[model samples]
Structures are given as C-alpha cells and as structure tokens.
Target: MKKLSVIIVNYNVCHFLEQALTSLAKAAKHVDVEVFVVDNNSVDGSVEMVNEKFPWVKLIANKHNQGFSKANNQAIRESNAEYILLLNPDTVVEEDTLSKCCQFMDEHPDAGGLGVKMLDGKGKFLPESKRGLPSPWVAFYKIFGFAKLFPKSRKFGRYHLGFLSPDEINPIDVLSGAYMMLRSSVLDKIGLLDEDYFMYGEDIDLSYRILKSGHKNYYYPETRIIHYKGESTKRTSINYVFIFYKAMIIFAQKHFSTKNAGIFAVLINTAIYLRAGMALMTGFVQQTWLFFTDAFVMYAGMYVLVNFWERHIKSDSDFYPPEYLHYIVPVYVLVWGLTVFMYGGYKPLAKFYHILAGIVIGTFVIAAFSNFFDAYRFSKGIIVFGGMLSILALLLVRAVVQFIQHGNVKIGDGRKKRVAIIGSYEESKRIDELLKDTHYKLNVLGYITSNKNDVTQKGYLGYLEELEKLVQLYRLDEIIFCSKDVPAHRIIEWMTRVDNRAVDFKIVPDESNFIIGSNSSNKRGDFYSLNIELNILS
Candidate 1:
C-alpha cells in the first residue's frame, strides 16, 4: 500500500505546476507516494506538460474547474494511501517532507491532520502555516491590526498563534490547505472536505471538524516546504476580497454559537465594506490632488511665459490685458485640466506623454474657438507660447511634487528612493533591462526572486515572505510586481501584510504593449511602457 497520496489541483499556472512536480519527484524518492494532478481545464497546456513530463502522475483531467475542495475530494476517494496530502501546485517540497509527515502521523495517533512550516517563493516563512480558529474575537483583532501590532501577545495574536515559535511542534487549531496532510482515518470519521466551500475556508472547516470528532490538528514544523501561495486566484482583485471575507462569514454561520455567529457575520461584512471604502477614498484623494496641482501649474505657465514672449521676444506687442488672467486664462486652465483628466492624466502615476497630448488638444480647441473673434485671434501666439511653457511647467511640477511627497527626484540619482522588483526571474530581469534608459524618482535596487532557481547571484534580494526585511535592509521606497507572475490577490495579501510601511507598490501588466495613461488604442504600440502606481495603503 502507498504510504501517501499527494493531490494537487492545478489551474492556469503551468510554470508553477511543472516546478512543483519536479520538487515532488524528490520528495517521493524515499517514500512510497502516489501523485494525483487534477487539471481544471487550463488553456495554458498544463495537461500536455504533465502527460509528457510526469507520466507517472495520476492525471484527472476535468472538462471544467471543480474547485479546491471538490477536486481534493475526488482524488481522496480514489487513493488507497493511508495519508492524503492536499498540496498546492505552486509549491516546492523538501525531499524529506513526505517522510517526515508519515513519521509524525505514525507517532501521533490522535492527530487527524498536520501541516509543516511553509516558506514563500522567497525563502521567508509564511505565518499561515499555523493558524487559530478565527473566532469573533480573533477576527476583530486581526481586522483592527492588533494581531500584527502585538503578535506575541496572547490576547491580540490568537488568530495566528503568534505566541508560539513557528519551529516548535504544537497542537494548532487550523492547518493551511497549501500543505495539509490528513490521515485516512480522520477522513472516514469527518467525511470529505466540504463541497460547499468552492475555494476559501474549506481547510478551516475541515480542521474544525477534525477537532470536533475527537482528534487534534497539529503543526509539525520540523520539516519545511516552499509554497508559492495565491497562484489559483489574483489576491488583489475585488472578487478575491469579496470571496475571502464571504468565506469567513460562511464558516462562522456553520460553526460558531448562534449569538456569536451572528456577531461575527456582521463584523466580517463591516470589514469588507470598510476596506472597499478606504480603497475608493484613497483613489479619489490621489486623483483630486493631481488634478489641482496640474491646473495650478498650467495657470502659472500661461501667466509667466506669455508675458515673457510679449515683453522680450516680441517687444512691439502690447502687454497682455489683466482681464485675460481672470477670464481667458481660467478658461484655458479649465479646458486643459478637463482634457487631461479625460485622457487619463489624473491616475495614481500621471503619464507625461498623455498630459502633453491633452494640453496640445486643448490648445488647438481653444485656438479654433478664438478664430471666431478678431480681438481674440491676435492672442493665438500667447496660447501657443503658453502651451509650450505649460509642458515645461507640468514636468517641473511633477518633479517637485515627487520630491516633496517621497523625498526623491528623477534627475538626481543620489536623491531618488531605492526600489526592488518582485516577480518571476525572467520578468524582473526584462523590466530591469527595459528601465535602463528611462528615468524616474526610484532607483532600481535589484530584483527579488518569486520562484526558486530564477535569480542571478547579485540580483537576488530575497523572496516574497522576506519582503519587509528586504525593504528595511535595502531601505527601499517602492516595490514593482510583474502582474503576470504574481497575481493581484497575492499582491493584495502582501500589501495587507506589510501595512503601515512607507513603501510604494506598483504592477507591470503582462501585455508588452501596456501603457499607463494612453486613452487611444493607437498609443499602445511598440513603445516601452511602465507605471509606478502609488500604494493606496502608503
């Protein structure tokens, strides 16, 4: 009989799945383990790669995605192994991982499920390796930031067992599904993973059931594995946030005492809405600030440059009337600002080319309107000169705004804030190479690897788990993520984890033709593109 059956539910993450299978090959070397990969209709040729390379793996190719719980249950029903491991496809296991789990299970008869210390693509430890039942109090503490502020305190850190050392073996309330190993006996007693949970909270439900069925869930951290977490879903997407919190509500409704469950449901929903509100508020403030700053710069540019051209360049021209400043100048400023706004100029990171184009369009529109009147027709040169000066003024204001806000300027390399890129090795390297000619207020410190064996010796900063440490060590001011490698959901989780830190977070979309603020489709041609979005949390 096989000692263990490892089940991995794979989606569109073909690269990560392939790497995981390679690591699993080493893990099963000394242990009698059968691997099952349940493909969820991935269009990325994941099925073909698995069939070609890892033919020994039991492939359960589903025409449609069966989700996390259902997929694991499908493999569990077919396997004859004494232990079943619900492993994530985006993970790398140590050679001894399977053996250690088997040994731990053999020694602990009362333990129904177990989990190991898991590290992220970066070699830093993931705290979710061991978690407590998210009761109402624990949820409250976590949502309010008390958990992170006082992780070691028993009162505040109940959710993640922050009082316990991650290396120590202990009875934990919850084992993360990423590397959860369950005894067959426990499954017989508690039944399969709850099919109701399509994705999130199923692990917690299973763990709670194990404890209820007279078995303890243990955190055996003697062995460590790397879990490239959040591959199945984009962590930063609004959909992810909604589903995650909604899962908590479902869990609470199922397990908590009636009175407490209702309270927890309310608290969780409130948190969800509060978070959404905060995000919207942040975006609004950022856009409003940029809009006003650009307007002020445009007004100043028209006032100074037009007068200089009239007095110095064309000395015969009468000095421009003061009424132009009050009536005509504001009209130009209003038109320019509105056009720029429509062209996507007031984004988290304003694009220079978009701003320039908007100003040009506004200038032409204003010039055409002035042609209707003979008196205003003569003032066309002023508008032309003002537009030129506005471009320069906008650039200067942007530089000044960046310097005042972040203590960094694009021209002065020494004054610019240091930054690091986090994503797949190739993607990070590509961005680093592309950013060579362009100038910004951030200095590319180097790249951090999001997966194993994907980094140059000098370029390696660390992994995602060690992001905060890397930020502190290098004194980095910003971190850019390649959206293709690190999903939005993972990015959101990372941002939440590093809350209160003074660092900007940005994403580079997968499409090579992506641009920050170009409205027309024609603007996204072969030109190089990059956008450094200001972190809303920051």
Candidate 2:
C-alpha cells in the first residue's frame, strides 16, 4: 500500500491545480504516495489538464459540481494508503512537507490528524492554521466584532485561537481543510467527513469527531505550504458569505445542544446579513473610489475654467445665472464621470488617453443635451473649455498618482512584464516555448541555470544560488521555476527567503504547458497555458 494518498478537490481553477500537482509531485518523491484529483465538473478544462499534464493522478471527473466534502469523500473511499491528505487545489507544498508530516504522525501515535503552518501567496501567516471551536459564546464574540478588535485576546478571539503562538506546535480545536492530513485507520474508525456540512464546516466537524474519539489534532509547523486563497470561490462575494455562514449554521445544529445550536444559528444568520452588507458596500466603494476622485478633479477644474470664462470671455460678471455654475456644471461633471466608467477608466492605473477620450465624449453628449432646456443652457465656450480643462486635470491626476504608486505613468500598454526563468538549459527552452503559446508579451531576461557548461547554457544569466542578486540586478517582475530541474523545496525556499513581494513566482510542472503563481495573497493564482485559454487571461 502507498504510504500517503493526496486527494485534491478542484473546481474551475485549472492553473492552480496544475501548480498544486507540480508541488505534490516533488513532495511525494521521498514517500510512497498515490494522488487523486476530484474535478467537480469544471468547465475550465480542469479534467483535460489532469489527463494531459498529470496522468498519474487518479481523476474522478464528476458530471456535476459536487460539494467539497462529497468530492473528498469519494477520493478517500478509493485511496489505498495508510495516510490520506485532503489538500486544496490552490496550494504549493515543499518537497519535504509530506515526509515531515508523515513522520510527525508516526511518532505521535495518539495523533489522528495533522495540519502544518500555512502562508498565503504573499507569505503572510494564515490564522486558519490553528482554530478553536465556535461554541455559542465564541460565535457571539466573533459575530459582535470582538474577535477582530481583540484578535489575540483569549477571552474573545477563540475562533482562530489567536492567543496561541502561530510558530508553536499547539493542540488546536480545528484543522483547516486546505491541508488536513489524517490516518486512514482513524478515518475509518471515526467515519468520513460529514456530508451534512457542505464545504466550510467539514474540517471542523471531522476535527471534533477525531478529538471525541480520544485522538489528538495537532498544529505542526515544521514545514509550510502556500495556499493561494479563494482560487475556486471569491471570499469577498455575497455567495461566499452565504455559503460559508450557512455551513457554520449546519455545524452548530449538528454538534451543539438544541438551545446552544439555536443561539449559534441566530448569530451565524446575523453574521451572514452583516457580512453580506459589508461585502456589497466594500465592493461598491472599491469600484467607485476612482470615479469619485476623477469626478472631484473634473468639478474642481470646471470651477476654475468657468470663473476664467465668466471674467474674460463673457465680459459680464452676472452674464451666466448662478444655477448654471452651481447645478449645471455639476451635472456635466457627473455625465463625464459616468462616461469615463463606461470607457473602462476605472481599471487599475488607467491610461491618460482613456481619461481624455471619455471627457471628450462626455462633453459632446452634455452640450447636445443642454439645448433641450433653457435653464441648463450655458455658454458653448464654457462647456468646451471646461471639457478641455477636465481632460487635463484627470490626465494629470492619473499620471502623477500612477507614477507615485507604480513608478510608471502607465500612459500606454507598451510596457510588458519583465520575467526571468530558473531551470536547466533544456527546461528553460521549454518554458520559452510555452510562453510563446500565450498572447501576453513578456520582456524575458533569460534563464538562471545550474549548468555552467558553454554547450547547454544557451540563455544563461547566472547560477540558481544567485537568484536574489539576479532579481535585483534585472528588476524582474516574475520568476518561473521549472520542476524538471529545480526541486519544490528549493523553489519554495527562494520564494520565501528572498522577501521580494514585488516579484511573482511561478512553477512550470515537468512536461506541462502552464506556469502558475500569485504575487499577492489577495489575488488569485493565474497562469498562461498552451492547450487552453482562461477568461482571466483574456
């Protein structure tokens, strides 16, 4: 029998799954292991990816979207191994991670399940690495905002067990499902993950059951993994809020007493509404902040232009009505702001050209609309001058702000992302070939290879050990690691050791076409694949 069986539940996150399998391939090398990929009817070619890139994985391609619990249970039933790891598709495990975890479980015979320290894509510690059960009081504290306000307080912040040091091996009430590994024998004794709780609460339910059975659930931090959170489900979405909270409600009903469960349910329901409201409000603010800034700049510029036109061109201080300056110009500014949004000016670091084009179009529309009403009518000269001034104001704001934030004005889309590859000569060539399959234009700075020979080092930049120096020298925006030549631990070591959040790190699995990584924990891991195209890439 295999020593370990790693089961991953994948939805539509094909790129993330490819990266996870790549990492898992290296991790499983030291231990006898089998792999299973449960695809929940993903429409993004996840099934095809497993077939083509990771044929070794036991693929259970469902016809419909099975919930996380059900899909993992399906794989658990088929897996013939001593240990079963329920791993998320959007994770990167180090080469020694599996061996270390297995060894820890072996030494601690009382341990039923185990979880390691997890970092998000940006190398930030994830609080879910250790958690306390949400009893009614814990739920009350968390829902009432006490947990967030006092995260390290043992009195209020028990949900995530914030009082416990994250670097220590502590007994936690829950193990995150993202990287939960358990003994197959223990699972058989305790029963499989409760299908009653769909996605969010299954890990807690299983953890509680393992504890109830007199086995310890440990938080092991000897090895770590990178979980690119929310690849399958956007945590900020209203749907996510509902699903996650509802799953909590299910856990309450199942585990707690009737009265406690009732209280917990009420709290979770309240949290659902509260979080849903926050999600909507946050989305609205984030989407429209740029619009608001642009609108204010346009209004301020119009004020100056109108004063100039009234004093110089009209030659009469009271020629234009007070309403024209007070109401009409504001209305025109609103129109300009809406038009800018329609022209996709709210995209990150929007170009000055888009802003200018939007203002010009809005000016024409407002001038034509004003002819219908006498009170709204103003000097055509003022409107034209206001439009010109608004364009200049908006353009200046974007250029200066973008330059301050990104070190470039981004006035055009001509600047391609600069990239460097680290691998053997042959693997580096494969990476270049795979990149050619995508439409993205990258300013590749060549590869850093271990081979110093003059024959194979065709595009050599430096050695693998000097990655930090090379990145600084070339000012690279992205790094792609080839799994065929570089081990997963070395890749992860470089990713965390460099402490460069500005550079995105990706991995190209051996014989695979895609390279995947996330620069920030908030952003999803994206990739460029040769065999398929994703909507995000478009």
TM-score winner among the candidates? 2
Per-model tally of clashing residue pairs: 7, 0
lDDT of 1 by residue, 1-538 (tens): 7899999999987666776787688679879999999998899889998998899999999999998899888999999999999999866666678898899999999989999987654345678989999999999999889999999899999899999999799999999998899999889988999988899999999999999999999998877765655667755446676888999998999998899999999989988888777767766776587678878888887877767877887784567666777788888888888887777666546768777888899889889998897765656778887777777877787778767765666522235658788887778888877776455445788888767566556787887788778878898876777766775446545754664346655555553422111111111101123433232112
TM-score of each: 0.70, 0.90
The candidate that wins on lDDT is 2
lDDT of 2 by residue, 1-538 (tens): 9999999999998878887888888788899999999999999889998898788889999999889999999999999999999999999898899999999999999999999988876567889899998898998998899999999999999999999998899888899999999999999999998988667889989999999999999999889998888889876679888988898888888889999999888889999999999988999998788778878888888877777777898887777778876888789989998888778777754667777788889989998988998767777878888888888888887777767655777654445778888887778887787677776768788998766662345577888778889889999888888878887667767887777878877778777777776666655666776666653331
Q: What RMSD value applies to candidate 1?
A: 9.5
Error of 1 at 463 (Å): 20
> Candidate 2, which segments miss by more than 4 Å at Cα?
140-152, 343-353, 433-437, 450-459, 530-538
lDDT of 2: 0.84
Candidate 1 overall lDDT versus native: 0.77
